[model samples]
Target chain A: MIRLGRKHLFEDLPRFFASLGGIVFAVQLVVVQLGIFFGFVHSSSLLIQESRADFWAAAKEMQYLEITLPVPYSWIAKARAVTGVAEVQPIIIRSIVFENSNGALDYGRVVGFDPAGSLVHLDDHPVGDLREIAKPGAFAADAGQLSSLGVSGIGAEGTIRTKKAHLVALVHDTQPIISPTFLYTSLRNAVLWSPAMIDEFVRDPFTSSFDINSPLNFVLVKAKPGVDLVALRGALERALPNSRVLTKAEMIDVTQRFWVKRTNVGFILGLCAALGILVGMVVVAQILYTSVNEHIREYGTLKALGIPDRLLYASIIWQAVVMGLIGFIPGLLLGLAVAGYAQNARGIAIEITLPITLEVLGLSIAMCVVAAVFAVRRAMTIDPMIVFKA
Target chain B: MNEPRAVIGDSIVMTYPSAAGPVHVLRGANIHADRGEIVLVDGPSGSGKTTLLSILGGILTPASGRVTIEGTDVTRMPRRERACLRLARLGFVFQGFNLLRALTARENIELPLQALGIRRAERLKMIDALLERLGLADKGARRPAQLSGGEQQRVAIARALAGGPVVVLADEPTASLDRENGAEVMKLLCELARERETSVLIASHDQRIAPFADRIVSLVDGRC
Candidate 1:
């Protein structure tokens, strides 16, 4: 009733600040970890999420967008014949080695799609013309990848697997976490000049093993209006028995799962966030417990004087809530600053949206209140009789 | 008519089980105080002076005894009900002047009144009057650490009397003070208890202030 909780907490300035520091550390850790988790999940599935296709038909073993085995290009005919399917386009994504004019070599993934197909869409964060990559030996890369891909700007000359290549257009926000960089080009150039396929062609020159017309990573399918995409996907899966037919949402889900569930990065970051909560709880509980111990005599006096146990416990809980609210602000601000740094300097995504901010604030307070439980238990056990002892 | 009995502890027995078996701290001790009377409990160390006071205040339940304050049997009542009765009709003073260190003198005095569910305006009015009457009006803004021993004890007295309780319990209220301060605290306490018609029960071994008591009960070997 007298704000005894806050008064008690602020009575010792050093310990109060120490308690605040713990909450701040916890809030920042949770915010940053969750932010990065959301960011990475978004980045990992950027290709599938941004594509303008109703469904994707990939090799049966494909688990994510980045790691697709080649499906037969001939399967394009079978997919287009499925009912409710309007169009089908074949695409290739393969790792390539690039050599710049200065002979600087770097590795990248090449995404080769036909311009006539409506599968690859970058309308949200608009980029340069897709038609530019249709030219022979021309490719498109995000501007952020210039240094990593060993290329300059547009019109920069480079070699892809010992063949001449040019940087024709620039895109934005299409960076992939699973691959170093994505170089968009025509299917003919990617199939002909991808290093892995070129090695096979050189090793078996007389065989048809390296035929360019047979290798395509995925077949993008478009559905007619009023078509239930789920039924169409089932039809495609049945017709193309060696392929996996997935709706656009399913593609995003698989990609996110591959990184979040199957990869160690997600687990370690998640563990760090949980540890932050634990550290916060420990710090706050220790501080509250110590404060109670120090003020045990006063508490006993109050109890002996007939103070209600409810009011006594409420004071401790109030201290925790105050600490949480006061400590969370700076931590959230610090998290936002770090997110900005990650996004700008390193091209890493760390999104701190409104929902994330609210969620973190709630978590901050919840952890502090939970921490107060320990102190409250200790306070409840104090014997009022002790105050009567001289 | 004789002054109404304000507090009574009937055959109170308190025991503790140790490695040596039951240690009887208070063995069937009986005590009572009338309204507006100042009663002193004097005994040697470990002779159950504090134990008698604790049972009278309902702080420690005797092994087999009845404690009554203001005509209510505190030992038989539920804990919460007993606590409510204690808040409304009884008060306690400890040896160390155990005021909450974080609160100012006025806030410390206001705590029990607040627990009694007194409104803020009424509580403030009562606290001001208590502070003024106890000679601590000007010093109510200071914390316990900032006050002298005598001043801290005066604040504790002000806190005890703020609720206008029917009975006040003091356990060695002057044990931590010097001779002059202890004498001064006893005089102020007895005067306030008389003026408020509050029964004052003090447990102390200080013989110098025995003159202030209306009656003195001495304990020896856990008996009175």
Candidate 2:
């Protein structure tokens, strides 16, 4: 039965190729889309992920990892005084505009950290250093952004919110979410550059609202050993009425939900993947229908010869499965290779693990089975008595 | 001596339902063929010649009357049982040569054996013998497209009888062939029936087919 089924499947090489083509296209679309979706989800929370803080304290509505308002910088001292708080670090994350080489306006997230604090992304110094960044109007920039920042080298200058910011040193792999142009500077200079927050005391010009010592954007907290981070979080939340300290998992969840579940990215990618599968299914079903129509007479002959419906059914299903497997191998490999390129150049992570490979393989087989059902229905209902007619 | 009847269609009445109305194709048609006998149902087009054969082969059920093959009544049986009877005991040759185009002559002949779950070695042996008997010994590997009309008919004949069925039904088997090929196919079927003691029931309007039949029953308006 298998032998006969295979011969019949290959009877029309074009139909066979068409079936395989549809499945391959579907698999590639699903794999690449899933990869890009995951990549976007990963980069969304990269800042919080890279930070060494066990708990992060932020303003009440700082649900998003990228944008946040400031809590008073003095909160760092108060948080350190808490029983289980090992250390507290002050940092400011704000959106600042920049001027490129051609004076074209570009904007990005500018981060300000306490110069003595330890939280930079460099190799030798696991924590970080702000010695060069502490210098007046100087900040460290990721070397990869030299061209984006319109700087020739160290000591080159760029305008951060119209303030003179000299690039003192370059760092590696500092791609922050929300904006690609990231600039790192000392807390004092960051406050100097950060626009002063406005208070409702706006009606009084004598009591100006432009205060450099107003607040800090983020307070990074490290918990002491033998202390439950969850309890410390509760304590910090209680100590600060309108603020929250989020854990790593909580932050990741918040970011993932923001992009995948709560946003349109997940819906759009899901629809594309489904469309790919749907296209493959429709192609296979249409092709199988043609194949069945072409061989309707043969099927009638088989029926008249006492061939059972089960054998006829088995033959069609086997053809579909064979085509699916054949298409899957090449499509999966090709899609993975393309995804690998996106991962490196576009930062889209298509981590095709072993389990994922097996899963997609299963999906391909199931896709063919479902496609075969369409042909099977037609085959089962074929009038075997057609052979009796002239 | 009373010879065993291989197929008996007694007062068969069948009507087909259509959008316009019920089509009265067969009305009280009676037919029978003895074992080792070659019977021909001669009729004009639309004379229920094909419909009567379909009843005997269990392809269609009659509205009235019964069809029995080798003592098994197929009229009251379910569709699946009737189909099983057709598979295990009946073979057919159609006008179109209906040889699975994807399969070679040998493979086509081996189809019934495959359906019956015959062992591969036995199936091959039966296919080889049938091919040799049909005078297609050297052309067993050729598909129907590659075979001449005469050769294709012979392959179709071999496929019909390969399962050693109790009866072989052929409908306008020679209609697609030249006169010479038609005569040869009829004569071959007659000879094989005599040798195997298998009953053969054929429907045809071609005069060339009559000479090869042991008996010819004329069907007019579904009456024999």
Candidate 3:
């Protein structure tokens, strides 16, 4: 038979495009909002996601990576003693303020780990020797934050916690979300710079005397090849009861959840995405409802000809699907453009991956399908005999 | 010999609820048409001509009456079955032509045939013949707006007959046309109905259609 729904949708060009515009607007809004939300989640958990460690042992009740209480440095040997444990390395995380030569100060995190023993993966964007971070006062900073930190390049000097700090390498893609700028260095420098470590021990920057007894943030653990991580995690957890032993995946999940569930920014972005879907739904529903009323008389004629109500409903739904598929193309394209601008200019990473693209498309189609209900109900109730009236 | 009764509506009564009260449109209307017969229902405005036709076509339920089409009682049939019966056995032509503006002439003629699950090859063959018979051969691709009023009516007639229904009901089929076009439509409709051995019912106040009817039944004061 004739494609009644498609024909009806296109019969009035202005109205048809108006409906499409509504769908496009909805798809665009959803794509951008959710895209940014995912970006935020990833950035907040970047270090954990990039870790090569099989498990992460942190202080008990550690909800966030940076805000955790210090894990006992004694956990290193305890974790190494567990079955299936290949190695353990202590890592320190402390928030510190740094000053440029002009006295402008900004905040940054000190991420210090034992380079020889740590299981953490080397960052792909760093442009210098990783081993050099073991040198006294040596650090790496993201190039993106150099101007804000009042540093020029690899050889620039800055002060952290009243101690002279030298930038030994330049890194990229370290744009921070919840945490501030990152300063990557050796564990000795981080320990000397930490206020807690310095207050507990006599200030001795030259001696560089820190041992396994020092309080640290986390311990990265590596499992023997082919070892069951679940079993290893249980052993480690039991061995270090004061620390939480989590698999790599579990640690990433916990960090992402902490940022998304506990922060106002995440909640606001989520609400904005929901509102976009709602707006799109209303737009499609109103457009379809109006289109149905405009063609009410034709529907009556079809009904009089004994066309099944189900077929009529199918026609209306077909129109909605067509609108969704057609509108999503432009919406996605626009969203990608906006995402790029946000990442480059605003420093807000919006990663619109293939999976995210498919998800948004599915949402777009579902929104249209739900919106078709009103139009279908109206079409079904039309009186067929009205065609008989003069 | 008496021809078989293709359609019958007896003592059909219809009422509509109004703010004032329940306004009765038809009371005890009775009508019948045999196979291959042309029946004209004549009446002034509000004389229940449309109401009687509505009842006979199973579009409206009568307060009290029985209707049978080719020996099948449709009055008590469920709405879905009544719709199926209409699709299989009845056709309607309206004053406004009632053609979907989005479809071409040929597609409109294919509506009922498609509804009946006819194959595409057979539908094309049938539509080609119908278009030729109705003098719409060259205009099959033109939408309703592109066709003139008379051509649109011819397409409507072709649509009604495409499924080879047993009964064809025309309600003011020519009311939108001029006198010349109206007469031509009536002549073609009556000829086609007779040639197919189908019953034709025309409900209208137009006097020009009287001469072509095999029988005329006057509906007045809610009775026929």
Best by lDDT: 1
TM-score of chain B, candidates 1 onward in order? 0.96, 0.96, 0.97
lDDT of model 3 at position A4? 83
Error of 1 at B49 (Å): 0.8
Off by over 4 Å in 3: A147-152, A197-213, B1-4
DockQ of each candidate's interface versus the true one?
A: 0.68, 0.63, 0.73
* Residue pairs that clash (backbone atoms under 3 angstroms), model 2: A306-B87
Any runs in candidate 2 off by more than 4 Å, and if so which?
A18-24, A72-91, A114-156, A167-180, A199-215, A222-243, A333-374, B1-5, B16-23, B34-36, B178-197, B207-214
- For candidate 3, the TM-score of chain A alone versus the native chain A is 0.89
- Candidate 3, which CAPRI tier? medium
- Estimate, for each residue in A6-59, the C-alpha lDDT of model 2 and write its tens digit: 997887898788788999998888777776676567767666677778877877
Rank ordering of all candidates by TM-score, starting from the highest:
3, 1, 2
Interface RMS for model 1: 1.1
Interface RMSD of each: 1.1, 1.3, 1.3
Model 1 stretches with alpha carbons more than 4 Å out: A78-87, A100-105, A123-129, A195-213, A225-243, B1-5, B17-23, B76-82, B178-184
True contacts kept of 2: 0.82
lDDT digits (tens) for residues B1-224 of candidate 2: 66557999999998999999998888899999888889999999989999899989998889999888887898999888887899888888888888888889998888888888899999999889888877889999998899998899899899888888889999999999999888888888888877998999999998888888989999998688
Ranking by lDDT: 1, 3, 2
Q: Rate the local accuracy (lDDT) of all candidates.
A: 0.85, 0.79, 0.85
